[model samples]
Target: MTTSSAPPVAPAPETASTKDPATRPRRRGRTGKPPSALLSRAGVTALLALATLYTLLPLTWLLLSSTKSREDLFGTNGFAPGDEMHLAENLRHLFTADDGIYLRWVLNTVAYAGVGSLLASVFSVAAGYAFDKLTFPGKERLFSLVLLGVMVPGTAMAIPLYLLAAEAGLVNTFWSVFVPGLVFPFGVYLARVFSAAYVPDEVLEAARMDGASEFRAFCRIALPMLAPGFVTIFLFQFTQIWNSFFLPLVMLSDQDLYPVNLGLYVWYSSALSQGHPEDYLLAVVGSLVSVAPLIAVFLMLQRFWKSGMTAGAIK
Candidate 1:
């Protein structure tokens, strides 16, 4: 061992930079991207920040404006708070002005958006799961029809829907709005994507082999996996229904049946056409009220929605 240890060690060749640390290039981070790529990433971040500001600016104005009276709203800068906060006054005015019909509109909106979205999600999930996992005659043809429905703008179909609703005597009722939304073609398409991506055919087959009926297997097994998809479809339809102005405008004449959007529109029009500016404030406050539910729903469901959106990204 002593003899082996005595073997000569070769002298290590030294780089010039190694000897003088100050002369050496600083080590970069392990980010494999080049400087241009880094700059591009920074640029993209800045662009997104600007876009976010652009989008939120009007909403910020709306929020600030809602707190002011009609007088202060017009007098003050859009982004600035008014002389006095009258949020409570505005809300009270909103509820009481139309004999509490605004509250009815809110309730009607909840019903249409909530129930219609739920039904749409269910129908979408069922149809999508069937289209992906089942083999039946006219499958592609039916899916093509659904795709065609998606391509046809809902607004273009509004007249057709109104005509059909008239034929069925469902016009001017919640059912008129509710029924049309339940067959959401976009929801079906999205559901198909999710079903294909998330639900495994092998698992369904296994469940079938284990003495489960198709519906039973779907409910007990596949449905749980489709949770994210359901949430996504629900949120989409909910937003659509909540923001739907034209359809409800066409369908319902009754103030009692009006959703928040249509009712708010009526107020906004009255404010403009009739020169009662306070009604404008009522419309603004009602907007806040209408938006609150959607915000709440989004915040509540975002976890599932985001996970659903990203789940298939890698796999």
Candidate 2:
């Protein structure tokens, strides 16, 4: 091969047109097969519709039942309108019955829930802020105790609280209900989480460097930022105090000091035991009236509430 006279030719690089169809890489695009039908848009929409129906059912029944007279209440369908509307008449009877004790109960409920929730929110936020920003001895241990409190149900604590109230000569008094409502362990936890998520440490440091006292920084800086959390805590505590029955039942024997929930219970019991259908009607209407404030409060603060609820999940 006397030096293989001609140089060997190199192989040509593959091109798209020259590549074999079986060897070519497939481009990423839609396939002929469709995705699984599970969790599709239609399925999600149906699930939401079902949830909405479930939630609205009771409220719808309550609204319809509130308009019915005693006869219509038992005679007609629960979800349908009555033969005649007795809403105005029912409200009149509700407010006037028992010398308008219902109004007093309403006021008591407002006071207990409003004042207690406000104070509780303030205290919780302050404690939570301290827990988050300020370091102290036994901080984790103290917080562990708070977490422990969150694990304990309110109903379980009712007996112990009643005993403490009795010991302090506070039973059957407003303080019995109002004082206990102020200690919200879960609210404290919620506020702490909110503080950690919402309040920036650098901002506090800047305030401190500018000669602001700790308390001043908290009030003027941290508080405004924590407004949503404050509203969240207030609403939670308000709803709890509003719906509380067992605690009031254990603490209060005087009907005059009763909250709306306990007062309505008394009316229902009287109706059942004393054969007073009018009392039953009063209880029904009173229940509807009692729910209105909660609805109004939620509607008003929903923006803040929604923001507060989602704050921890973001960061």
Candidate 3:
């Protein structure tokens, strides 16, 4: 006998750990997140919800108040719906009261936002694409100046812009609002980011090799790819031009040229000081109506924003 068969030859060492992949404690990813992380996430979500409630509370009050009679607004709970809904009557009075001046304001808003955003987006896209793809003297310097302009708040430049418009005899005219809205530094910056990311150099080179002129290549090849970015720029500028208050206030003395925001402000001021505080309800209703188009536009165009960001990032 070979000395008890050398103790039955111990099995080869397994080496691997006994822990199973599924059963073992996770070292990374969601399973690895500590209870503290979960608690932190919960805290963040709750904070955001509370912030949303805070922001929306005034709008909620406005809606409820708009439905109530003057007496009910003062007497009843602020959030309670009144016994009667006068929103329709209020709207009718609003539209018909001033010889349909409100409609003109609405049209003016549309024109300013539409024309301004379109022109601004075109200018921004062209400038951005040129800056990114074309090599020119002082390109970096010009871009840096644009960035500096971004840092300067529009309010600070409002007086200067007004003065320039005044000198050019543009004040109190639609051009006062439209032309200023069309020159957006932020739009230019966004366009540059998008152009750099989307319009690949190789593609431009190929287009040039095909004997396509620079403008032709851009119009035919690059512009299609830039469509998403254009929409994003348009939406942003649209919202900005639509919501602008101070510029319009400074530029135009004629109430007929007012956009919805300025028009609403007029109502609010009148409602407060004119002692017909009951008219406040109309102001609230008008506010609600004013925001509806913006919400609709965002919902419709948000897909373009997503696609554009994705396209640029992927490229």
Show where candidate 3 strays beyond 4 Å. Answer: 1-39, 83-85, 308-315
Q: Which candidate has the highest lDDT of all?
A: 2
lDDT of 3 by residue, 25-80 (tens): 64665777656653687888988899999989988887777777767777899999
Q: Which of 2 and 3 is the better model by TM-score?
A: 2
What's the alpha carbon RMSD for model 1?
A: 5.4
Higher-scoring candidate on lDDT, 1 or 3: 1
TM-score, per-candidate, Cα-based: 0.85, 0.85, 0.84
Q: Model 2: residues >4 Å from true position, as ranges?
A: 1-38, 83-85, 306-315
lDDT against the true structure, each candidate: 0.86, 0.89, 0.82
Candidates ranked by lDDT, best first?
2, 1, 3
Model 2 — which ten-residue stretch has the worst lDDT? 306-315
